[model samples]
Target chain A: MKRYAPYIIVVLLALLPFSGLSTYMMHIIILMIMWSVIGMAWNLLGGYCGQVSFGHAAFFGVGAYTAGILYFKLGISAWWGIPLSVVVLALEALVIGFICLRLRGPFFALATLAMGEVLRVTAENLRDFTQGTLGILIKERTWVEKTWYYYIILAIAVLTYIVVKKIIESKLGYYFVAIREDQDAAESLGINTTLYKTIALVISAVLTGLAGAFYTNYMGYIDPEVVFALHDISIITIMIVMVGGVATYWGPVVGAGIMVVLAEWIRSLPRIGTAHQTLFGVLLILIIIFLPNGVVGDFSKIKRALGFGRKV
Target chain B: MTPLLEIKRVSRFFGGLAAVMDVSFNVNKGEIVGLIGPNGAGKTTLFNVINGFYKPSRGDILFKGQRISGLKPHRICRLGIARTFQVVKPLQRMTVLDNVVASAFLRSDSKREAVKKAEEILEFTGLSSEKDKISKGLPLGMRKRLEIARALATEPELLLLDESFAGLNPTELVQSIEVIKKIKERGITILIIEHHMKVIMSISDRVVVLNYGEKIAEGTPEEVSRDPLVIEAYLGEAPAA
Candidate 1:
């Protein structure tokens, strides 16, 4: 049953569009899948590698801009941005890793956060290049129907899941966990921690970049503020993984679903729409207090608390 | 015969203080050489220098006649030099078998081969029963054994055991001594830093004594034990005569 769970989920999701869902419902699903992609990317570096990054927005924004600039400057199809963004983002990741991977723990986190903010400010100031916060407009999207976008993101999510799963089961995965558990021991055992950490960072950054490129092609418009927002992109990515599960395979998927749905639900409330972030803040605090390891990580504890399991 | 490992006038300094000062030693292949010193006498520091954790401030280290003074730790490990921590560093959340397998992966590219090597090492270290247990949950004795299991999995030509018997009970100590003997039988040279005098004297083919970051004596274990300078360093200057 456990082995078949992923297949079951893929089958179910593949058939969901045939259920005559509203356009808005499809949008929510697409958003959920997209965020899950980002969350999984973050999980590879922050979860397995133990290098928490607060600057994923840097990669995200760079990816979006790669697509946006190609379309805006070259008059080319923005779909080209999807493949081209990988090159752009990998270079960006290399630079980021060189500078930030030298620092550990909160220092690394802060360095990434600072990098995101720097990119945002640079995007805003570079008027001719990034349109200086005037943002970029695709003018025409590839599809008028939401169905194609949903399917594209679904396919990407599946690919990301498979890639991450494979990596976590391989020797590289063990090396990552060893580094996370103890860097010194990992080094002594002949694992080059720096090289491995950079590999995790590059893979993570490229995946997140793909999601960002997809966002620009789908959303039709993007601004520096929206793409590079620290709290919105970077922190939310971390929160999605944290609220779901730190190191578990299914944590980001569950977390993204909950966060996206809760966000939409809160926004739909007329009187409390503005308080959605406050609700998220409260939820984060509660999760940290009661489930420091995140929901998936603390699943057994949660089950016991809810009185569903046998007494120990 | 050339030594399997050689330390030539090695010194490691932190700012103005030298932790290991011009300490020279050699371990011939297939011998157990014990390094005994009082607390803070820089025995572990010397081990650190030998294993490429620290660059010697003023000297050179050679493994099998090749200079390896400034190489990185992993590179050194890959060059057939492996060392355990004085404070055992197990990959805490990983199972004992997995921890050993990780080290075994250094020499074996195939995961199946690595697992086979890890299992063999586990059995040899007497940790087969606890193979599935989390490393952090193991008792001190077992954790120490896990450390040896992990180091051996690397298939080192020279294994440096840093205080492997530091916190063992009498039975565990005897078991560890036997294990070390078996490791020696496998024809791997060992340079061990041990605080227990009796254990060192019994197992070491030769002993080197350090006092305040300098070598005080080097001879057969019996000869070093009877050396007056070694006694003075451990017992403190005979009440200033």
Candidate 2:
């Protein structure tokens, strides 16, 4: 019964789009779903592998640009580009992981940041192939129903959740957390820490790339900064996990919802200067200094407090 | 009865100073060998070299009749080696059960099965009462026990423990000695680095004394304790501690 609770909750959330929200609201719902999925991917590598990447924007850009170029050159549909973008970005992520994944903490963050900068600059420079920052203009799909987008995003988000959840629950995920907790100790446990870390980064990069592809087509354009902006590049997602709880399974969801909803409330209004960021900062500080366990973290604590998981 | 583990001419040079130079020893299966040395005697560094944590500047390490030198730590572990840290490295964010289960994942695939085994291990090690407790919140004694549980979870044939009795109370130390003895009864060879002379003398089948990274003497605990070099090496001139 206890083991089935997470599955039951996942099923309920999976049924949300089918529950008939309005089209505009469903679009926002889909957007949140997409962010949540991407954020969760970031959580796998950033939060799980303990290699915080401040430059997930690079992988996101690689994915969007892969599909964008294929559409412009080979006349391929975004659907076809999904797999292609994933493959391309996954390979690129592998290369980046090899070079950059060896670093940790602030150094790793800096490496990723530099990689993101280089990718953004290259996208701006590659004029003929990428339309040189004017961005790739994608045609609206035949099925432009906002409801379709919602369902599509919802389906993928559910899948992303399951895969990440599985890996985290499997021999692999245990290794990731072991590495996250202590690399030396993980190695002693027969965990190939470096190899496992890179594998997590690759899986995470591919998923985020897929999100980028979906996002470029969903929004109908692909400028380097807009699609691959650090704002969109799981940075918000990392913040979400940190606020929600960095390494927990449900942390990403809570973190994403908290920030995305708060940002939505602000973006719905007239222009506000750093109002969203200021709120995120203040909220983050409070969470960091006080509610560090995050929302669901409290649930675990509550369960323990209630003597559910305790031995006594 | 043969040497199940051997370090032959192992030397580790950092720049020019040899932290561990040409040190060598042997341990038979199921024996508890205590490695005792003074401060800066490179006890932990020698353990690192044998367990594949640090590649020696020049030497070869053998286990069960096969050369195990220059292997990555994980591969060395896969070949039936496991160790604990001087500073216990429990996954603090994880529960006590999780720390055990993570190491158990080395041998099992099913979470349910692995977790069940982990629970039993904790029970066996007298930590089932703290199963769901946050690892970091555990007292020092419990944390040391967590480290032992993790090492045991690997199903190791040879276990290397660093400073397991460093910060334990008398009761805890006695409890841990019994646990280590029970672990040995299960057929695992044990190598421990300890400063607790009484614990070493009480538990070790044989003892090796090191000074300035050199093997000063090797024999039964009482024999090594009486040697001039072992005395001068570890105890200043007094021979009694």
Candidate 3:
């Protein structure tokens, strides 16, 4: 019964578009799925591998640009960016991992944050290549309806979910956890910490790049600031994973759903729309204080607090 | 038979201080050689160098006649040398079985095979009863046993036990001695760093004593225990007539 939950949810979501939902509702769903993809990717590296990144926006933006540039320069369809960005993002992941993976803990996080900022600045400066700060515009979008985009991202999310799940259940997954728990111990026990860490980073970056490519095709436009926004792309990716659950499989999905809905609801307010970020900040603070391990991670505590189960 | 491990004048320095200075020793195949020293006498530092955690500032380490000094820890581990930590470093969130299974994966390609091997190791280490328990929740004695279980899962030819008996109670100490004996019976060479004189004196076929980063004495456990230099190092005074 528990095994079928994800498939059941996917089936229901697949049928959701035919339920006469508004365009706005479909857009929110798409955003939710997309955020979850990014969240899951981040979880692989940060939660499991213990290499928390604060610069996922770099991969996200690089992926976005890979598609955007191919469209703007070569006049090819941006959809090709989805497949092409894998190679691009992998090289990016390797270079970044080589430089940033040497630093541990918060220093690694800060280094990634700086890497994201550097990419953002680089995208803005390279006018001939990235169209400068004006960003790349996809004049002709592939889809007129949100339904197709919704299905596309849902497919990507499902793939991400399966891949992440398989890896976590394998021996590679054990190595990641071992490295996270104690690197020296992992090494002494014959696990190559650096190699496993790089594998995690590469897988994570490539998945995020896929989502970025999808965003390029769906949104029809992307500026460096929009795609590479520190708080929005990178930190929010962390937040989704954190709010969902750190290492649990379902954490990011639940986190993305709540965060996307909350963001949409807060932004829909007339006078308070601009203050949505402030609301998010408060909510994040409360979640951290109350559920440091996120919702799924602290499910027992939440159940107890709500008086849902039999007493111990 | 060639020695399983040979350390020739190994020295590890931190800044200007020599933590392990010009220390040399060897462990013959299938022998349980005890490394005994007072605190700050560089026993752990020497273990670190032997296991490739620290590169020796001078001298060479030979495992099966191959120079292994300065090799990465994992590479050294793959070359059949495995060591436990002085402070136990069990993968805290993982179960004892999972911890050993993770190490078992080093040799076995199949997860099922690794798991089967890990269970056998756990049984050997007498940790089969607590296999499902998270390592962090284990008592100090069990945690040390888990450490040995983990290292043994790597199928090492040379097992280096760093202070494996540090905090064990008398019963636990006896159990550990039996476990170590069983490990030696499997034909794996054992080099152990221990402080408890009685424990080391009982199980060790030979004992090497270090003082102030140097090999002060080396002989049978009985001989080294009665050595004048070892007595002075441990007691900070000459032995009474």
Candidate 4:
């Protein structure tokens, strides 16, 4: 039963769009899955590889721009951005990794945080190229109904989940965890820490870029602030992983569900709608203090606390 | 015949201070060479130079006649040199088996093969019983042995042990010596830096002694122990008449 949980969950998720959810609910679900994709990507680099990056928005923005530019400048389908972003993000991740991976711990985090702001500023200044603050708006969306969009994002989510699982189970995953454990020890054991770190960065950035590309196609509009957002994209990506569980497989998914659902539900509440951010901040603080490993990561502890499981 | 490892006048400087100065030595194939020195005598620094952790200020380290002085630690590791740190570094959160399997990845890309190699190393290191336990929870003696087990899993031709036997109890010490001998019997060359005199003297084929960042004596264990300079290095000069 435990082993088949993921398959069961995926099947349930696939059937959700057919159950006649309101368009708003479908939108929220789509956002949940999208955040999960980004969360998983961040987990790969930060949780497992031990290279915490706060500049994922750079890759996200670049991905959104790739699709946006395709439609706006080249007269191509914005969907092409999905495949193109992989190549674009790989190159970007390599360059970013080369600069940031030389620093460790908080320094690496700060470097990545700066990278997002740097890209946002560059995009704003490159008026002819990125249209400055004017932002790209897709005049015609690929689909009018939410069903097709739902299935497409779900498919991408499934693929992302599988790829993350496969990578984490293989020898590459061991090298990642080894590097995370102790870089010097990893190098002494014949693991090329730098090469593996770059690999993690590229894979992570590409996955996040996929989500960004999908976001442009789905939402149909993106600007430097919306796409390369520090608080909205990068920080939320970290929160999703941290709240879900740092390194556990299912942590990000559960975290994304909580984050998306809570934000939407809180905003819909009549009296407390305006205080949602404050409430959300307090909730996050409570979670971090009590369940530091996130939901899935600390499930057993929760069960035991609720008197449903055996004590250690 | 070319030695398995040749350290040629290696010197490592931190600013003006020479941590290891003008050090030279050679370890023949299939020999266990002990590197001994007083507390601040640059033994670990010399090991660092040989393993490529620290670049030599003015010399070369030739492994199988290939100069490896400026190579990255991982590159040197792939060239068949594996080392244990003076402070044990276990992949703390991982199980003991996984820890060794990570090292075994050096020789095998297949997970099954790496796991098999790790299992064999764990058995050889006498840690099979504790293989499933998280390494961070392990006692110091077990962690020390796991360090050697991890290094062995890399399938290294030259193994550098930096104080691996430092914190072991009497029974663990005997077991460690037995494991080291068995490793030698398998034809791997060893260069160990150990302060445990009894363990080093008993197992080492030759002993090199250092004092004040310089080699003061090099010979058989018996010869090195009897040398005036080595004695003076260990136990300061007798009061002047």
Candidate 5:
């Protein structure tokens, strides 16, 4: 009976929008899912391989703008654009990851951060292609489209989950863990740490890129400043993964959901608009210090509470 | 039989310091060789050059008749050479099984096959029951066993082990010695850097002694044990034994 618990929660969550929920609540739920997808993408490299990157905002923005450009300038649909964005993001990540992944420890993080800065500056300066940060406004919804946005994001989220799950269970995942554990030791054992690290970053970039494309169109606009903000760096992504539990498959999901919901909750308070980020930061620090392994490390406890897995 | 590994005057210089200078040795197929040295004698550095962790500043390293002096560590590993770190760097966050499976990934195509083989190897190294346990949380003896399991998973023809018997009780040491004996029985050549004279003397077919980055003695275990140079290198005087 408890084996069906995860499915039941999923079903309940799935049916939430159809339960006559307010539009605002639907927006929050959609936002939570989007952050969850983003957090998970970040975790593939940051969590599994222990390569922390603080430059996901650049990939996210690149994906969003790629789709936006194809749709507005080339007269392509988001259906085409999203895949293209992923391809572009994957290729770019391949190049950047190749260079950045060679650097170990904090150097890897620094290199990626520099790469993100380069992207952000290029997007803002390349006025012809990116509109110099003023951004692009979609003339109309790309699909039948408001309702489809829900299904579309959900599908991408499902795809993200499965892809991440497969990686976690594969030899690639094992190699990633080895790389994370001791890169020198892993290489000595014939595991190519560089190759695996680059692959992890590319896979992460592709999924995050796709999610970015979805996000832009769903909001019906694309702007570099909003998309490429350093605030979106991997630290926030790290927060999600760490607060949930790094290297655990569903860790990012739980962390991202809670973070997004908490952020939204803070925004709901009167006169809390400017104070929200500070609150989030403070809460993040507290959590990191106290719950470093994360809130979900107690899998048995969670399973018992949710009525899944096995006897607690 | 061809030598499994050959080091011909391979030297590594760190600035003005020669960590391993003019080091030449041959490890024969299915042979267990002992590398004995005093503290900071560059035995580990010589092993590093052989395993491709550090490229030799001069001379050739031939593995199975192919030069591999400056090859990437992973490529050398693929050429059937694997090593354990002296520091015992177990992938901290990964489980014991995952650590072994990661090495198996080097030679295996499928995850299922790698995992199955890793399970057998884990058992071979006496880590089967601790398969689900995280490696970081394991005892030092278990970590050593896990390291052995990982090295075996790569299907290496030769293993360059750095201090395999460092932190172990007598019981654990006996078990590890038997495990190493069993490994040699499977026809894998072993080059071990160990401070435990009794273990190395008993298990090694040949022994090489090092002092101040240079080889000072090479002979059969009995000859090496009685060599005045080997005793002087380790103790500054001849051993009464």
Candidate 6:
């Protein structure tokens, strides 16, 4: 049953569009799927490999810009950006890993955060290339309806899920966990900690880049502030994994669902809509305090707390 | 035949201090060589240099007649040298089986092969029952055994044991000695650092004694125990005798 669960979920999601939901609801679902991809990507480096990144926006923004520029400057369909971002993001991840991976723990996180900000500023200043703060606008979206967009993102999410699962369950996964647990010991055992860490970074960066490319085509407008956003792109990526589970495979997906829904619902509330972020912050704090391992990680604790499955 | 590992005029310096200076020895194939010293006699530092944790300040380390002095730790491990830390470093979050499996990957790329090898090693180390348990909460003796199990998974030709018997109770110490003997029976060379004189005298094929940063004596356990320098290093000088 557990082995077949992913396929069942995918089939159910594939049938969701036929239920005839409103356009607004479709948008929310698309956002949820997209967030899940980003969350999974982040989890590879942060959770499994134990290299938490604060500059994931750099990859996200670079991926978004890859699509944007191909359309704006190259006079090509922005959809081409999806395939092209793989090559671009791999190189970008390599460069970022080289600079950031030398530092350990929080230093690595801070370095990544700075890398994200640096890229944002670079995108802003490259007026002719990136249009500076003026941003890139896709005058005509590819599809008239949200269904195609939903299917496309759904496919990407599925691919991301499968890839993350395969890597985590394989020999590479053990190497990653070993590196996370004790780098020195990993090295002693002939693991080559630096090389494995870079591999994790590259895969993670490339996945996030794919989502960023999808964002450009779906949203039709992007600026340095929008795609290269630190709080919006990077921090949200971390929060999703934190709220879901750190190293567990299902953590990021569950986290994304909760985060996307909570963000939308909180923003939709009247009178308090502007304070949605504040309310979200409080909720995140509470979750951290009560469930440091996130929802799926602390599910047993939650069951106990709620008085379910008690022998008494 | 050439020694399996050769340490010739090796030294390591920390600023003005010499942690290990001009210390040299050889471990021939399939010998359980014990390295004994008082506190801070560069025993652990020598292990670090031999395994490529720290490059020797002076001299060379040759493994199987090839220069291995400046290579990285992982590179050396790939060349069939594996070492356990004095302070055991286990993969704290992973199950005992998983921890060994990670090291087993050094010999085989297949996860199944690694797992099979890990299980075999767990059984050999007497850790099969606790293989499902996470390593973080393991008792000291079990953790020490897990360290050896993990290193053994790499299938090293030369195994460096840094105080493997340290901190174990009587039962664990005896069990550990049996494990070491069994490891030797497999024809792997062992270089062990041990503080317990009785265990060292009982199991070691030969012993090397160190004092302050230099090799003081090297011989059979009986000969080394009887050496004046070795005795003085451990028990200090006799005023009138």
Best by DockQ: 6
* Each candidate's clash count: 0, 0, 0, 0, 1, 0
Q: Which portions of model 1 miss their true places by more than 4 Å? A: none
- The TM-scores of all predictions, comma-separated, are 0.98, 0.92, 0.98, 0.98, 0.94, 0.98
Candidate 5: stretches off by over 4 Å: A1-10, A143-145, A299-312, B237-241
Model 3 TM: 0.98
Q: Candidate 5, after superposition: displacement of residue B156 in Å?
A: 1.1
lDDT of 3: 0.94
Model 5 lDDT tens row, A1-312:
776765786777767667887667777777777777888899898888889898888788888888888876787775576889878998989889878887988998888888878888888898988788788887787664244576678778878888998888887888787788788998899877778888999999998898888877888887777778777544567778877888776788888888888777787799986687788789878877766767777556556767876873
| C-alpha lDDT score of every prediction, in listed order | 0.93, 0.84, 0.94, 0.92, 0.84, 0.94
Chain A only, candidate 2, TM-score: 0.89
Taking the tens digit of each residue's C-alpha lDDT, what string does model 2 give over B13-64? Answer: 8898888989889989989999998988988999888888899999889998
DockQ of model 5, rounded to 2 decimals: 0.87
What proportion of the real contacts between chains A and B does each prediction keep? 0.75, 0.76, 0.84, 0.88, 0.98, 0.92
Q: Native contact fraction of candidate 1?
A: 0.75
Error of 4 at B172 (Å): 1.4
| Rank order (by DockQ, best first) | 6, 3, 4, 5, 1, 2
Better-scoring candidate (lDDT), 3 or 5: 3
Error of 3 at B147 (Å): 0.4
Lowest lDDT 10-residue stretch of candidate 1 chain B: B232-241
The regions of model 6 sitting more than 4 angstroms off are A270-272, A310-312
lDDT of 6 by residue, A257-285 (tens): 99999888888899898887788678789
Model 2, runs deviating above 4 Å? A1-23, A232-234, A271-275, A299-312, B237-241
DockQ of each two-chain model: 0.84, 0.68, 0.90, 0.90, 0.87, 0.91
